[model samples]
Target: MKNYLNSTMIKITLMIVLCMSAFAFNDSKVSAKDEAIDLRAKAAILIDADSGKILYEKNANKAYGIASMSKMMTEYILLDKIKAGEISWDDQYNVSKYAYKISHDTELSNVALREDGVYSVKELYEAMAIYSANAATIALTEVMAGSEKNFLPLMNKKAEELGLKNYTFYNATGLNNKQLKGMQPKGTPEDGENEMPAKYVAKLAYQLVKEHPDMLETASINKKAFAKGTDDEIMMTNWNYMVKGGIYEYKGVDGLKTGSTDFAGQCVTITAKQGDLRVIAVVMDAKEENGDSTYKARFDAAKTLLDYGFNNFKMQEVMPAGYTFKNNKTIAVKDGQKKEVAIEASKAISFIANKNTTYKPKLVLDKKEITAPVKKGTVVGHVEIQGDGYGYIMPVKDQATVVTTDDVQSKGWFVKALGGIGDFFANVGHSIF
Candidate 1:
C-alpha cells in the first residue's frame, strides 16, 4: 500500500508540472504578441522618407479630423505660387475682417493681426508654420486664391494631385466652421472641419518636403517674434514641441506639423533623420492610457513610431547592380549573333528591413526570350523583394528594373536562311525515321 501511494503521488506531481508548463508556454505567446509597439493613436503610419516605402501602419486609411495640420496644404499652395512667380514672399496682405476677428480669439493660436495691419507673406507664413496662426493662414489663402472660399478648391485639387484619396478640406485654417462665425467657406456645414487619413497626412508631409524642402527652414524655428520691434509685435512659439530646444526635444527631430481640437484630439506629424535614414511618422488622435487626449500623448505616439523605425530597421543593399538571377542567368535571343544573352539588375536595390528578417528577391521577366539586336541596357524584367510587410507608398509595384548585360546583334541573312534549312531537314529526317 505504501508503494502504491508513492506511485500515485509521483503521478500527481507530473500532472502539476505538465499543467504549469502549458501555462508558461501560453504566457510566452501572449508576451510575444504584446511586444509589438503600440502607437497609442486612433491612426498612425511610419514610412521611409527617401524611398516612400511604408514600414508600419495601423488604421492608416481611415479619415479623422485634422486641425491645424491643414496649414501644411496651405503652405504648399503658397510655396507653389511663390515658385511660379505668381506671388512673392515680400508681397503684403491687408488683413480682412475675418482674419482680424479670428486673430483676436484667444481660444485659437494666432499672432493677433491688426485690422489695418499690412503683413508680409513671409511674416504670415512664419506665423502659420511656426505658431499655427489661424488668422495668418486665412490671410495667406486670400493672397493665393483671392479668398478662402476660392482656396478650398485648390486645396482639394492639390490633395487629388498628390494621390491622396481620403481627404476633405472645409477651410484653409482647419478650424471648425462654427468657429468661423458665419464667415466659413461657402457650402460647408457649420460643424465641418478638415479631415484626412494618416496615410494622406504622411503623403502630404512627404510632398511638402519633396517639393518645397525650404519649408523646413521656417518650420524648424522654435520661436520668432511676429513684426519684431514694432508695437504690433507678438512673440510666436512653434507648437511642434519636438523641435530642438522645446520640451520633449528629440534629437534629429525637425520641421513638421502638430494639431489638436475638441473633435480632432491631439495629433502630430514628425520627420527625423539619423545617419542616412530619414523617417516620417504621423499619429492622429492620440489618447493616453486612460483614453484621455493630452498634448504629450501625440508626441509620445510619434516617438514610439520613430523609435521602432530607427531601432528595428536599417537600410541595406538587398541586391547589387549587375546581380544575376540563379535560375535565369541568361535569356534566349532569337536570330542573334549569340543564342543567349546574360541579364542583370539595372540598378542596385536597397530597402529598409528588420534586422532579424531575411528578405528574398524574385526576378519577374517581361519576356523569357527576345528577338535580335538587343541593346546592352535594354530592360527585360524587374526584381521584386518579398517578405516585407509593406510596400512603396505610391500606388505602383515595388520593383527594380533588370537589363541586358551586353548587346546582341542580329545574325546575317545567309546564316538565318541556313539555320532555317537545317531545321527543315532535321524535321524531315525525324519523319522518315
Candidate 2:
C-alpha cells in the first residue's frame, strides 16, 4: 500500500503538463486508423474513460438532439438524492396523473404507468435506464425534486460542474416537444426555452457507470417487473438489443443505457471492462440508407473501441513511493543529516502501452538532491517513463531513515539542550590546559 502521491497529482492533472514544461514537444498524433466501423450519427464520441482520450468521434463537441439520453442526467440526479438519504429505494411511488397521461399522449416509450399501484424509487431507475421508459423518468424527476421545474436547474448545474460546456436540460424524458411545433402532443419549443445537449452523451454515461459501478448489476438485467410482493403488475424489458442477446463475443459487457427518437434515430451508450481498462462508446442519430436504424453500427463501434483498448494497452503499477524508482540521487536530509531519512512516494502512476510498444518509463525526480529528517509520504523526487507509444511521470522516495551527519557540528533541537553542558566542559578543559 506504499502508493506514491505526488504534488503534481494534487494539482490539476494536466495530463500533458509535464510534457509542456520543458519544450513545445508535439505528441506523435495517432491517426486512429480503423476502417471496420461506420457511424450514421451526426455526432458521436468514443472515449477512454480513465484518460478522457477521444478514441473516435464524428462531431465530438457538437450539440444535437439527445432524445432519451437526457434520462441519464435524470438518473444521476435521482441517485444523488437517494445516496444523500433524501429518498429511499423502497419509497412508494404512485403514478401521478401527469405520468400516467404521458403514456397515452406522448409518442414516446413507457411501461404504461398504473395510476393506482405503488413503485419504489429503484424500480423507476431500471425502467428509465434499461427500458427508456419515458413515463418512469418524468415521474421520478417530479417526485425526487417535487417538480421538473427544480430538477432541471440541478441538471444544468451538475453538467457545468463536470465541465460539460455544451449541455442544457429542459425536461427529464428528453422529448423536445419543443421540436414538434404546432403538433398535438409533441409541443413546440417554448418561445425562449432550450434543451440539455452534450457532444458525447456516451462520455457522461461512461462516467455514471464508473462512479456507481454497482448500477451495472441492475443495468445488465434484460427484463424485470416491479417488486413482486408489491401491488404492481406491469412487466418491463431492456431497450438495448445487444444487451438482450448478441452474436458477438461481448464477454464483460456490463452497462449502460439506450435511447431513440425520430430525430435522434438509434442512439446507444455502451460500457465494458476488460481487466482494468474500460471504454465507453456513444452513438447518436444512427440511421442507414436502407431506412433501418444502424443499431449494429453502435454495437460494432463499442466492440471495436473495446477491442482496440484491450489489444493495445496494459497497466503497470509503478514502484512504491519509498523504493528507488531509478538510479537518480535520492533526496536526503541536508543540515544535520547523517546518511539518509525516510521519503515516500506521495502518488501512484499507471502506464498504458500498445502491443508492439514496450513499457520502459523514465524517471524524473523533483530536485537533484534532498536532505532529511524528512517525513513519510513527503515529496522528494519524481520518475518519468516513456516508450514509443505510452509514457508516465511519477515521483520517488528514500528507502531508509537518516540522522544528522555530525552530532557536534549541528545545533538541532536535542543538540541545543546538550550544547550548554558541552560548552561548560570546554571552558573547564581550557583552564586546566
lDDT of 1 by residue, 1-433 (tens): 9999999999999999999999997655321112378778899999888877888888888999989889899999999999999999999999999899999999899898888899899999999999999999999999998899999899989998999977888999888998988999889998998899998899999888889988888888898999899998888888999999889888888879999999999989999888888889999999999999999999999899988889878977877888889999999999999999998888887777666556677999998899998999899889988766667677755568988999999999999999999999999999999
TM-score of each: 0.86, 0.65
lDDT of 2 by residue, 211-240 (tens): 676777877777787555555455666666
lDDT of each: 0.88, 0.60
Output the number of the lDDT-best candidate: 1
How far residue 29's Cα lies from its native spot in candidate 2, in Å, is: 12
User: Model 1, which residues run further than 4 Å from truth?
Assistant: 1-35, 336-338, 373-377, 395-398, 406-433
CA error at residue 208 for candidate 1, angstroms: 0.7
